[model samples]
Target chain A: MSSATTFLLTTIMISFIINIAISLYGVFAKPSLVKKFIALTIFSDSVNSFAILIGFRRTPLGYPSIAVMPSPPQSVEDLKRFVSEAVDPVPQALVLTAVVIGLAVNMFLVGLIMLYYKYYGSTSTRRVKI
Target chain B: MSTLQDPLTGIAPLYLIAVAFLTAALGLVIRSNKFFKVFAIVNTAIVFAISAYIMHKVVDEGIQLYFFGGYPAPLGIAYEIDNLNALLGLLATSIMLLSGIYSAWYMNFPRTYLYYTLFLTLLAGSLGCLYTGDYFNFFVMLEVLSLSSYSLVAYFRDSPKSIEAAIRFAFTGIISSSFYLLSAFVAYASFGTLTMADIALKARDLNAVTQFSGGVVGNVAIASAMMIALASWTWTFKAAIFPNYFWLPDAVPEAPTPISAVFVGVIDLIGVYGAIRMFYTFFGQGSIALQFRSYTLEIFQILGAISVFIGVFLLLLQEDVKKFIAYSTISHLGLIFMALSLDSGEGISAAILHTISNSFAESLLFYSAGIAIVAVGRSINTLGVLRKYRVALAGIIIAMLNLIGVPPLLGFWSKYLIFKAFLDTGKIYGVVILVLATGISAIGYFKMLFSTLKPVEKIREDPRLRNSMLADITIALCVVILIAIGALYMLSPSARKFINEIGYNVIEGYKAYYAFLSSGS
Candidate 1:
């Protein structure tokens, strides 16, 4: 890997980690339910992005290709090379599923929070009694 | 029984998934809650039958594998059935079946079709958690299970307490599950695969490749440690251990009693199973994660011991009957985790056995607590109302004794095994923790038992409470199963041997676990 490319990648990865940390702090330290929900959204999407980073790969052509077969390979060597060049589909599929689930859970929690507000007229964490 | 049934292991979970959606669709078309309840009961019965068949097939054969889309391991989703998960399948199905039957009489509110739909979906998600052979599948199912549980917790949407409990449960649940998902990412990034058995094989033999990709590509030790740290937090929360246990006591007491019973017995168990899968199966005997695993397990042991003391102390101070039972459950789960952290064959087996008996015992208490407190309200002082209902009184006694670890009862042997495992591991403090937790929780148990003996006349005039034959039958059945299984454990050698083998095979049977995928590297 070239030094410039390595430096750019390292900086991007560090920022991803920082984003995750900040979102988690928001989730825990924020007092309002809506703000906490927003934080949760960022947290999950950040992790989903992290997953894409895991499965992402580059091709010899300087740009990466997905796991899909662009064209049929004729020889065994061709198929083997195709496998090596393509990005892993598993993590992509995983990220998609995680994002969908995160959406559903976020919707559910928000709905619950709305109901909670109707009962107490506030989304602040202080109003919820044990 | 026949060659045609070879693929039933794969078909069983799919059947459960199909039935979950079918139950949802049935609720929409059929507006009658009675019809919905009966449909759910029948569906649970059939699911139980399928699980029994899978259990039989698994015992006759060894591990069974079914690849989705006929794609080989590591490239497609897989369902691997070994002795451990197959046994859990039977346990989960049976618990839900009993729950289905009991809930028929218990749930009287309108829009109860929604409740039944969520119930079946919870069962489906729990079964998926138990039966799945892939990491991503497990994460998705955990979400399914958590979402349903959160909804069910706040099923009484009008009540502020239910909403409060649901919020606490949901926030912790979502965050914990996301952490688990992150661990899965770390795993896939380093291992180049997400299939569990493939990961297991490669974790032990670093150079081993799956059918689709080469394995252990980068920084295996750090990745494994990260996965363990992330996954254990989720597992501990799901299982309701210390520091992560805030939601359980609140959630259970607010939800309807049958849902409370199922939550304690079935839903929380997914975490224990996940921990075993990671520590014993995936991160098993070799790989470079050994030092990190041992260090983390020690931390887990300390956490488990702390939870035991914490649970018992809080349990004694509880004023509500249902919350008392939930606290008792937390302590039992603490015992299970302590056993799990011991990381020996006997420890795992004891953990598994304790889980079964604890589920039955806890559910038995919650089922009987229904007649004891619901009509009168949640106060523990009203347990004297239970005195008039002879069956509930007996159920409470047996259940309490079972939890308190009376000799020859169902809970005793599992507790005995946990203690023995602790002693064998030279962790004398674990035994001290066990004995102290049991002794302290006993005070709470006896308080409940004695309160029932008092002369409270509030429930004697309630006619609606006297006519619940189905609920009584469920309670009686739990008592009988508890005594029967305990007796069978005492008298039958094969039953004892079978449980021992499951505990033993969980860690040692890795070779056979992956042997089904002969074509995979």
Candidate 2:
């Protein structure tokens, strides 16, 4: 709603898009398995950040907001007002799970790469054929 | 009706998942192959029993909803079971049971405990995916299934090819799942809820409000389409549909045979189920769906047509038996997709029947192929070596016929229903494509049979074929079921009624689902 908030959101959006583009290029273009894994990690992190961005909210006072459990309010009216100011928490929670799953996948990829290197003496996918 | 007091609602679905995880932990602690084998079989059998009971309860008492930790549907995770999920749950558990039995004698890896643990975990994750009613929970379960499958594919760590296949599968699978997560995020942002029923309700409300106010609902429509597109990409990838099927043939053939059975038979079906559930239950009646339904169906039809032709052509070229079976699976999955894309009750029923029958046939094919491969040595890819093994060859022929949709087999009835669905819709192009694909697929199967059954001058008896009673029994059981189901269909009216009931339950069950959720029951 405000210029500062709009600018911040725009910057985050642009950075996230650029991160995804570069990571996707790396994943598809890189011949080495390790590079692809790194690219995938970056890609997943960008997705998580993008998800968090969707949950962002701006208050009437032109400040960024987050959803938190409000401590006791003075009245029901006060509680209603506070609730309207809070950002969505669902996407943030989803991002948390995504990050953990991403870590598990990345760790598994790293182990697979290690095994690949040990077996074929190279980490390049081009060199490994079934 | 009082919701929280109903003990049977929540506990039935959780039993399988809990038992699986408990057995997995026990496998880790004990590290004994015999102990884990027995544990896995017992747990899968129990899950199968529970699944059958849950199916009966669901059909008798209506849909069962399970909220976690006493929390309600919108706020906490829930598992919803209608006839559709109950049927799928039953199928998955039964396949896991058979696969477990087959693995007991088939799997000879040094790390048997780890294998059983991962196997059981995979089954649990699949069952969880089938049972869960929440979007985020479904994604988590999918990840569980994918991770376990990747590990299982690379189970033969000593073989470079298996590990290579696993690497490719894991990367592609992870990318697909990331897309799914992104779609879930979009859906949540649009609807502010992850529960499928709640989302459907809010989506309808949003559509109504936007239409009344003459506001810009284009953004909402675009978001819904984007979500569907993203999720469909993941599903098509997992189901080995057109343009995303490169990993399957490589991944499936390299896994151990029992794991291959699970991959081709059970895991891929879950992918199809996800697509159907998302499209039919969550988005079926929404405004966006109403706008995009025909377009989506067209896209699926085209893709399905491509997958069928390409799969059969590739199947005709494969020298390896496992790869051939994998290609056949892709072809059959394409047919299932086409049937589902018809978006009719008849279409859905046809797809479901095809799914069940195909699982049995494909798994039996894989098992028989594994036995034959063992008898001839793994390197002997040609079918000439199969001449000595008469029983395995017979099993393979029958299974292949089931796959080719020979009359009186279970496959024929399902295919006939799919064709009838096409005909009812007046989609002559779909009917033509289905007929052509079936013909080409039959040719491929005939080629395989001829190669295996042709007379050879000398037959060398392999010692490995001498003591293959486990595989023989497994194949025989599958064959018996395949023929028995076909015979029942031809003889009994109740069999047809049962299938139609499930069809109605899935196609017409969404309204009841939404109403129940809205009432907070």
Q: Who wins the DockQ comparison?
A: 1
Model 2 C-alpha lDDT per residue in residues B1-521, reported as the tens digit of each score: 44454555455436655665676667667756777777778878877888888888887887887778767677788788888888888888878888888887687657787788788778878988898888888899899899999999999999988889999899889989998988888877676667877766655566432111122223667777888888998889989999798888989888889889999888988888988887777777544556675688789998988898889899888878888888999999999999998878888889989998999999988877787666553332456555665566777888888887889999999999999999998988878888888888888888877777555454347554566777777777888878998899878998788787766765676677767554634
lDDT per model vs. reference? 0.85, 0.80
Q: After superposition, how far is residue A35 of candidate 1 from its true place, in Å?
A: 0.3
Instruction: List candidate 2 stretches off by more than 4 Å.
Output: A65-71, A128-130, B1-31, B207-218, B378-391, B454-466
Q: How many backbone clashes does candidate 1 have?
A: 0
Return the TM-score for each candidate structure. Answer: 0.96, 0.93
Residue A29 C-alpha lDDT in model 2: 84
Model 1 docking tier (incorrect/acceptable/medium/high)? medium
Kept native contacts, fraction for each prediction: 0.90, 0.72
Best candidate per lDDT, number?
Answer: 1
Q: DockQ for each candidate?
A: 0.75, 0.69
The sequence of per-residue lDDT tens digits that candidate 1 reaches over residues B54-101 is 888788887767777677767878888888898888988988988888
